[model samples]
Target: MSTTTTLEAPNTGTWDGGNEPMKASYGKLMMWFFLLSDAFTFGAFLIVYGLARHKHMPYTGKADDFTFSTEWWPIPEKVYNAFPGLHGMDLPLAFVALMTMILILSSVTMVLAVEAGNRMDKNDVQKWLLWTILFGATFLGCQAWEWTHFITGTEEGMLLADGTRIFGANLTMNQYGPPLFADLFFFITGFHGTHVLSGVVLLIMIFINTVNGVYHKRGHYEMVEKVGLYWHFVDLVWVFVFTFFYLI
Candidate 1:
């Protein structure tokens, strides 16, 4: 007697002919293509951010207050308030650090989940996927906190150096460092957050399947790998955010 085995190209309806030498499943190949396009989107965004920084920002503080070669935009600390009730704390970057660690950790957990799936260890897969989901959610919570703190300063009214105030207003060009800065911040981060939010939902779906023995019945877990690719992409985007938004 002879037996035959077949491999399914995951997350796609296409039947594999088993002769295409590229060999990866449809899900993974699509992830690679999506990442390529995503890279271009981020490049465009960073390019614009660079352009914004080149134009000298209006400075309220005396020249001595300037840092980073005396030509940088307002110190991120002065512009973005991260710690609540820590007036003049000079610690705006700390929250971003937390956000970064959470995302990176989530990526690590995702890899673990993929490994567990490869080993056909259903219990381990479930465990690692839960951890991945938790870390991703924590990052989202931190981002939500960061956004809230930045939008609402301690004074209740947005106050200028000379005591002028704007209240209940999204920081505009005249209000915040630059209108474009605020706009780009919202667009990029919001887009990224929405991705995280979707990843969480998909993870939940996969978790439920694992619990219900979907992979067990199918005899494999390529679905987990498909989702892991998306999880990693979200983490990669935050690397850009940390570099461009916080570092330089």
Candidate 2:
């Protein structure tokens, strides 16, 4: 008598095995997921800004009349024309453009650091990481300076016909056309600056670990690659922020 045996099929529902979903490590995959969610948040913020700008933009026949009108939005070029050390010169978007370049350079250094890690070159990794940190710090410093300048109003601020002198920007008031403009500027740029600061801190910790030969002992520089991914993401987000806030 011949008997047939039944076979059991493999379970593909739950991922219980040691396989990575996309060949990415657990930490890197999680980082990617977090970045994806964060991208949605930024997108929402930018969309709201666009809608607000269109709704509140000046449509009056006289452009000069709507300079300080609450119903109109301030012209970005006029507001951000001041530059460091060249106070009287009208250099619109110069400082912000420099900040963007600094961030891009930092991303390049991050790439070099990741490459060094792949080659197991600890010294080169440290050098590149240090450069990246310096660039990040410089960018943060520039932001702080810009914020201070914005808070300190110009000599002749937006003076209204009602004799209400709007000096500087705050949560409730702004020397600019509308309070919403300042509000969005503070919220969006402040959020991005916070991310840059956090990335710097993370890079510092990773730098310490690299110095201590942690990854070297592990025989892989996956940590550096992971942090590089984060750094690149931050840089990419800044590009969008710059285009939305400054360029557009």
Candidate 3:
């Protein structure tokens, strides 16, 4: 007597990890994973910020006695009023709004670059990518100027009850309500600024490679698409930062 044996076929789905899931290449998928993890980091920072703000927010009562006080969370509009070349004009969010617009425009240019890449239009891709880099660099410069203004502070910062004379923002103190405000400001914006700077560098490198016909030689412009994903992520994160840090 002979025993009959049946052999099952091997699984051919993503469980085998043999195919490009979602039609994304390994590099693109990895870029996405990196962005997702980075998003969680930013989210945690923002969540902490929210909790701190809630915990430290000044108490309010009796509208008649309610007065603008340094004890409360610093009003973003009042804090960010100064615009470049407009000394003491009280512009109020103008510079920040401009920065936001600049970043958004750069995101748009990145979209165009990716679109041009899809067509394999090297010249157009180069043009759009260069514009994106310029905008990003300009935004960084603006942020540096803003940081300088913040650090230097006004001629005299708000006086405290103890009369300790808070000058500007540092790790230990802030002219604003709580030191944590400035701490989060520096950490969050500084982190985002670093990302922008890095994106600019990456754009420069990809620009050079695009000119050198690297992508053309490869018969595709997936490099531009990959970097574009990063660029777009940076821009999206800025929107959230702006909402939480500036608008809120």
The true-structure Cα RMSD of candidate 3 reads 6.5
Candidate 3, residues 164-200, lDDT tens digits: the string is: 6667788778885678888999999999999999999
Tell me the whole-model lDDT of each prediction, alpha carbons only: 0.76, 0.88, 0.88
Candidate 3, overall lDDT?
A: 0.88
Model 1, span 58-79: residue lDDT tens: 4656745543222335556555
- Give the poorly placed runs of model 2, Cα more than 4 Å off: 1-21, 59-68
Angstrom error at residue 4, model 3 = 42
TM-scores for all predictions: 0.80, 0.89, 0.89
**Superposing all C-alpha atoms, what RMSD in Å does each candidate have to the true structure?**
6.1, 6.4, 6.5
lDDT of 2 by residue, 1-248 (tens): 65987777655564655455598788888889999998998898899899989888564546444355566777677678788999788788999989999999999999999999999999999999999999999999999999988887677788887887878788888887688898898988998899999999999999999999999999999989988988999899899999888877
Collision count for each candidate, in order? 0, 0, 0
